[model samples]
Target: MPEVLFPLDSSKPFTDQEKIGHNRWHPDIPPVATIKPGTTFRADCREWFDGAINNDDSADDIRDAPLNKVHALAGPFAVEGAEPGDLLIVDIVDLGPIPQEEGSLAGQGWGYTGIFAQNNGGGFLTEQFPDAYKAVWDFQGSECTSRHIPHVKFTGIHHPGLMGTAPSAELLKKWNKREGDLIATDPHRVPALALPPEPDGAILGSLSGAEFDRVASEAARTAPPRENGGNQDIKNLTKGSRVFYPVFVPGGHLSVGDLHFSQGDGEITFCGAIEMGGYIDLHVDIIKGGMEKYGVSENAIFMPGRGGPVYSEWLAFSGTSVTLEGEQRYLDSQLAYQRAILHAIDYLTKFGYTPEQAYLLLGAAPIEGRFSGVVDIPNSCATVYLPTEIFDFDIRPGADGPTQIDPGMGAPRSANPNL
Candidate 1:
């Protein structure tokens, strides 16, 4: 075990922890600690919702999930001698769920994948799944099994959902301006387009009173992926991956949280991924002026590791830009992917899975989503691939039809009252 720089108590609230972390991204939140360039450290992370979400059979927690306080990040661990224009190299050495504990808190031998209700925060398929749903999964070694769903077991690709270097004051201002401008367009929309900085539930490390107020009001919410790399949610960032983040502030304030035991591409559900609270062992180094050296300035870039679960045969589904209602859009890759996922859900229903269970499965399972065609005319073609081995029976089409599996209780659902 490496030095536990930021230790979290699963029994305590995130705010009550000894070493507090900020949910929002701001340069002035201050670093919890400083480390040299070649240091390997361990940081315990709280699940995004802390302990608010229970390991239960209700989707009410998912329905009423706290959207304001999120992505309870571990730190803005200042790297000694790092400066603006430098590139911060982060290597994901290892990570997993909380060890040797089993209880209510997520990652204590279990975790969850949730579908956020439309009124809260709509997901990729929110229009199709307007209500909230949840699937609790139990961990056995490296694999997880869900009672809410059935007949599926697979290895998880453990990784952090949120990790980044802090933005400089100027860069932070840019984020607020753009996101605020976008929000101004649809300020009253349910699950607003972009979240603005809220002062209500901010935990800015050791800052207090007036300073906290100023920082919280101006800080960017940790929902969207920004130049500083807040929540990119790339499932490929498993162990042995190396991410290069552009340093926009002195000391390169690197922070990480929102760990996931497993996630498909896109994290289609808003609360997608087998959300967990876990520890990450990271090795950090600096590339002096490497941002300009690598011709990268804004977004973080990375070389994904090859340690993810391997499945040679995949049952794939494809979709075009046409919407479920038959409305066609031009070169809409995003819409194409959505249709592909919806098609997968529809197909899974043949096996007796409720749409919610199938949707949750697509979000948590290591399904591969890709663009099969984008250059052609009015429609982009997207495809989603599911590993055949994860399921007990054959999912392919033949003279023998789809095998029916018990969906158990199905995914627990809560209808949106606002609807």
Candidate 2:
């Protein structure tokens, strides 16, 4: 019989800290269970605020919500037989929202603020909309009625906030020590000691040594981890999508938190598409050669790859450049650009297209590239766009299967070649 790993419980608030340890599994510390590839598990996830904030709650409610109590998730269940250097293929079978109180809004819209910025600009409304800005505009009113843009479709996609194997014990230990030391230091010592005497002078002494020690103790409790082992918000895993994670320790302790309903790419504002929760159905499958490549790395997920000769309404290129002062910034920018393009080409070639063919296709299409950001360290990124009308081929299918090529790869390739 299939096991009910994380059963649904509606009696408790979702974001309660005590609930995380009770509901989720950690890989390195202890083993949850061992399961075969086809084993299915159920996850009972909580709303983003664990019922702290409601849909009818105002922005003030969000601002006042406890920061630590936000973004709760369920389970780090172990897939039996999953070992190091193996991949756990997860297939999402079903996701449903458990009915809440009558006036409660359990699941709602989903999207990321960062993705919105990619399409729009990054700024508050003062900068985003300076003049004639209407706080609430009616679509059926004169302005929108005269415009050609019409409402099409809207979807709310749900995905996890945090999902990954626990870090090795050694790493966690080192993190505790380093962060612990920093937290033991006081931030207000210098100012407190340097305060000038008032005219009605009462010389205020510095904090007692014992008081300083206490301050450090409190700060240490809230210090960010010395290592990046804490919560990570990767908004890619959605309902019906599969995530392959690398296993570290036995039972591959896995923990998840931070649930968003729908989000755009980039997640710029540190907030996600929509913060809500419901139920998630997870099927854990073990794959050989999957675990060896686990953990966050440069080449893991967001590798540069050519997407198309597929059509786009408009073509645009975007990139970022980094510079070392007193050195060649432009040269570095050029090198970064080349690297990004090469990476894209390398990714595209994996789809069975010859290097030369991919290059030609990129050149023939209405491609445009531009700089994205340059202020960060080793700044870099480049995006090329090609108009959809130029190429009669599809790029979406390339993700699932091998690309089909004509007998002789050339400008006039087959319109529909058998794969």
Candidate 3:
């Protein structure tokens, strides 16, 4: 057991923890702890929603989930002697759901996947799934099963969904400016184009009064991936992964949170991954001046870990950049991926799964989504590969057709005021 630097009590609210963590990102938020390079330690993480979501069959919590208080991170633990222009080498040693615990809190032998309502924070397929839905999954060792989405069981590919070094004051200003400008384009859009710094639910480490007021007003939200690597949601960052983050401040203020029990390629649903609160063991080292030494000046460079479940056989579905309305968009990989996902959902319906159940399964399973073509003229092609083993029956198309499964009560749905 490495020294537990940032401990968390699963029973308490995130704000009630002894060492409080921040939800927004800013340079002056202060470090909870400091450590020399080449040190190994453990940190406990709260679920992104800080336990606001419940372990129940209703999707009401998902519909009204507080987007302001999110990504309850465990650190900004300063790496001793690291400075701007250097590279922070983070090796994810080990991590998992709360060990030996079983209770209402997520990651205590269970977790959930959700589809955000279009009125709230919509997801990649928000147009199709405009309402909120949820699927609760019970974990058993490395595998899990969901009653909301029956007839499916799969091994998890657990990993942290958000990790990054703090952005400098200059970089932070740029983020605010760029994002603010974008929001100005469609300020009233549901789910908005981007989230601005709101001081309502901010929990900055120790700052208060005027300082807290200033930072909270300027700090960036931890939703989208930035140059600082905030909320990239990469599913392959499992154990043994190596991430080289560009250190933009002294001491290399690194923070991490939003652990996922499992997630597909693109966490398509807003709360796509099997969200959990867990502990992560990390080994930190610095490359001194490796940022410029490797010609990687911005963003993060990572090597996917050798960990996670592997499946060789897949039933693949591909789609071009044509909208559900049959309009073609040129070179839109995102739209292509969206169409591919919809195609997968359509195919799964043949097996008796409601579209929401299939969508939740794709978001939580170890499915692989890849970009197959982009150079083509009027359309790009994307492919989603579903592991055949995860399903109890054959998923591949054949003469016998799809095998039906009892989808149970189906995923819980919420009343969406927006729709």
User: How many clashes (backbone N, Cα, C below 3 Å) per candidate?
Assistant: 0, 37, 0
Please provide, for model 1 over 87-121, each residue's C-alpha lDDT reduced to its tens digit, 9 standing for 90 to 100: 99999999999988888889999999999988899
Residue-level lDDT for 294 in candidate 3? 96
Q: What digit string (tens of lDDT, one per residue) describes model 2 on residues 215-319?
A: 222221111212222344444455556666555556655555455544333232233234445566667776676544454321123222122122336434443
Off by over 4 Å in 1: 415-419
Q: For each candidate, what TM-score against the reference?
A: 0.98, 0.50, 0.98
After superposition, candidate 2 runs with Cα above 4 Å error: 1-4, 15-34, 99-105, 108-153, 174-232, 288-290, 293-419
Q: Give the TM-score of candidate 2.
A: 0.50
Give all candidates' CA lDDT scores. 0.92, 0.39, 0.92
- For model 3, what is the alpha-carbon lDDT of residue 56? 90
Q: Model 3: which ten-residue window has the lowest total lDDT? A: 410-419
lDDT of 3: 0.92
Q: Give the Å error, residue 253, model 2.
A: 1.7
What is the alpha-carbon lDDT for the whole of candidate 1?
A: 0.92
